[model samples]
Target: MNKYERIKAALNFEEVDRVPISLWMHLSENDINPKSLAESQIEQTRKYDFDFIKLMPFGLYCVEDWGAQVQYYSKSNQPPIVKKPGIESIEDWGKLKVLPAIYGTYGKQLQLAEHVSRKVGGETPFVQTIFSPLTVARKLAGDRLLLDMKENPAIVKQALEVITETTINFVKANVNAGVDGFFFATQCASEELLTEEEYKIFGVPYDLKVIESYNKETFFNIAHIHGDKIMFDLVANYPVNCLNWHDRWISPSLAEARKRTDKCLLGGVREAPYFDGNNKKIRDSLLIDGTVVEIGNHVKESIDSVDGKGLILGPGCVIDQQTPERSLYAARRSVYTGAHTLV
Candidate 1:
């Protein structure tokens, strides 16, 4: 099957020739320079034969657009931090300026996606990443937002409503730009950060609203849970076609997740400790075998133990900038080989 067919089938929880695969890489200078990050991503997908390519433009863009100071870091690390929470007080919420969706960081990503889709000519699926409403609220308010959730519950809810509306608009813009789908990542809604009750009250409702707007043919929405293993139930219940999370670090395993929901599962391998070049001690690190065969074997094991028809082999999270190409290629090899057995 072609890349588009493979991903479409996986998202619908249908059988395909093999499990589809995607790589989540940051829009860093390494991938962005020379050919532009989007162009480079397409080149990499074509070169390695990945089913999907995820574009995670730095998160600071949204925060910066809200008037926070941001500092771009050296190429070695992820993008710079949005120095202060953009919304300082409840009063700031009144003055809260909603920037145009196409004016800030997200717009740049859309441009890149357009270029890639045109370049690839529908052969590959292009996906753009967006912060979940609650996640974006936390980034804009930091610990203050969490405190407000307890101290000033009303204000928090009010702010989330506004952010959720903006997020829906953002998702719509991406769909308009011809992105094949979206990777909706909820970073701060984890159990460690918020109680299940809190997630249901604040996170899930708003996310469902945002997703409901774009459940059309042009978009395959994937909900990503960045942390909080205990909250698998919350993630399973989220209104999305696919579910992705950090499977390597925390698990009832993908097999257990399969029992909870029939949504397509997009991850099981470790991205940072395994794929990142900085951490060599881990067994799956690039230094271990330096071939796709090693990485492919690991991914195959995870899929074989779960439901292969609904599995998408990928790093548990975004691949760090310095991750070896070989490690990523390993994932691609695993997809095509259709090898699911542990041996």
Candidate 2:
């Protein structure tokens, strides 16, 4: 089966020729430019032959237009970092206004989606990365938003309303640009950061709003729960086909996740470390020797662990941009090599 066919079958919990594979990392150097970002992703897709393209737009773009000061270190390999929050005070949250999704960084990302869609055509699916409204609020207010959620609850809700509106507009634009679906990322849905009741009040409502905006419209929406100790049950029932989390680093292993929900699971790689100089690291109780054979063995075992159906081989989170090229190539090779053995 082709990449698209394999992914569709997997999501449906049907048999696949081989489990689909995809891995994403920040392209910090190229993300500042639309053409460069699109080109880099397209080039790498051909190089590694990933199953789908998950557009890695600089994560800060969601709140950059909201007056959040961001510092881009071109000389360094790191993605852009936020220098200051957009909402400085409780009153500032009330003063926040909705911005057009078609301007500034949002517009550039739309252009990127259009370009990639045209190039990829229907051969491969490309998903736009979107942060939940609460995640955007965190980016806008930094860690202080947590305090304001209790001290000034009303104003925080006002800001989130505007943020939800802006995010929905952007989601609409991406749909018009011909994206297959969205990779809805939620970074603030952890017990460590907020209690279950707090997330229910401030998080899930707006997330459902943005997701329900395009629920019936997209075919491959994926709910990516970022960070450990994630509130897995909170987002388990969202209108998405796949659930991606730090499964290797946290609770709810693939087998356990399947018991709670039937959505396709996308993980298995112990992403914290992909390669070693000596090619020795503990991954799924196996030692990696930085060779194609070792990588194939690892991938095959991961797929078998999940029973292969309803599984997509991928890292728990983004890999380091500095990861070795051979490691990625090995991942791709593992899929094909494993396919032959399974057949």
* Position 25, candidate 2: lDDT: 83
- For residues 232-342, write the lDDT of model 2, one tens digit per residue: 988988989999998876889887898899899988865775335686754422222345566666678777777888998888878777767877887777776333233
Please identify model 1 stretches exceeding 4 Å from their true place. 30-35, 217-219, 274-293, 338-343
Question: Per-residue lDDT of 91-183 in model 1, one digit per residue for the tens?
Answer: 665555555577666566666666776777577777777887888888888878887788778777887887877777677777777887778
Residue 154 in candidate 2 has what lDDT? 86
Q: TM-score per candidate, in order? A: 0.89, 0.93
Cα RMSD (Å) per model?
Answer: 3.5, 3.6
What C-alpha root-mean-square deviation, in Å, does candidate 2 show against the real structure?
A: 3.6
Task: Report clashes for each candidate as comma-separated counts.
Answer: 1, 0
Q: Lowest summed lDDT over 10 consecutive residues: which window, candidate 2?
A: 281-290
Q: Which candidate number maximizes TM-score?
A: 2
Model 1 earns a TM-score of: 0.89
